[model samples]
Target: MRFDLFHTRVDAHIRKAQEYLQAANLARIEHQIAADHHLALASMYAQRVTWLEQELSESVSRFSPPFRGVMTVAAEGGKRGAESVVSLQRSAPVSNG
Candidate 1:
């Protein structure tokens, strides 16, 4: 094998650049899929918590007649939020979505 220091250095530089590019590509992909797209799950949980809080507040209302309208609205909003989450999950790619 011929040992050309200049060619060896160039080859090393090229390899390093390729590795850096590969790392950058991987980072971009990872950033795009942060949390494995479990954001929908988090959103679902948050909406559920909100609904529960509203329900609890409505139940403990001092008024003689609890506010059914507020409760109903909260329930529907929670339901919609859950449905949307499910929809999003279903629509996502099968693997690593």
Candidate 2:
């Protein structure tokens, strides 16, 4: 189904976004100013935002049950992982602040 394809794309992008976001956060904490990390983060986010917005634009269409469940789980896991990293980063002290 078309929705399945879109869901799969979204899941793929989400996974990549999660990875890049993690790396960006790590680089930020490590004081790496290579800028590539920031660029990667921005690219990942752009892909994710585009995919999500497209999905939202077709919100009236329903996804298959299994695909819907998978997407939900994937998104939730991504959010939890990102949040954990963010929390850790916040609690970490700045050596040069």
Candidate 3:
């Protein structure tokens, strides 16, 4: 697939995932503020927020580097890290001078 299509799809996916992340945060706040508040409910939603964040990160890592410093490979680790670096290099624009 062309980089344009890939970028577009990835952007769309990230936007959708962001909505879920926001919902998770809202749930955490709501639970925290409720009269029957239980820390566990807020904690559960907080964990969901973390999971969604990682999901978004992994999704971004799959894309062509949109720009410099896309994903710090160290944050990814292992084979996936190597693959993202290769993908970023390959997708890097060729400069003419």
Q: Which candidate is the best by TM-score?
A: 1
Candidate order by decreasing lDDT: 1, 3, 2
Q: Which stretches of candidate 2 lie above 4 Å from their native place?
A: 1-33, 61-97
- By summed lDDT, the worst window of 10 consecutive residues in model 2 runs over 80-89
Clash count list over all predictions:
0, 0, 0
The window of 10 residues in a row where model 1 has the poorest summed lDDT is: 80-89
lDDT of each: 0.68, 0.66, 0.67
How many clashes would you count in candidate 1?
Answer: 0
- For each candidate in turn, the TM-score is 0.46, 0.29, 0.31
Candidate 1, residues 14-88, lDDT tens digits: the string is 999999999999999998798767897899999999998877776757543324444545566755432233211
Question: Which pairs of residues collide in model 1?
Answer: none
Local lDDT at 76 for model 1: 64
Model 3, which residues run further than 4 Å from truth? 1-36, 67-97
TM-score of 1: 0.46
How many clashes (backbone atoms < 3 Å, residues ≥3 apart in a chain or on different chains) does model 3 have?
Answer: 0
Q: Which stretches of candidate 1 lie over 4 Å from their true place?
A: 1-8, 35-38, 62-97
Candidate 3 residue-wise lDDT at 24: 99
Clashing residue pairs in candidate 3 are none
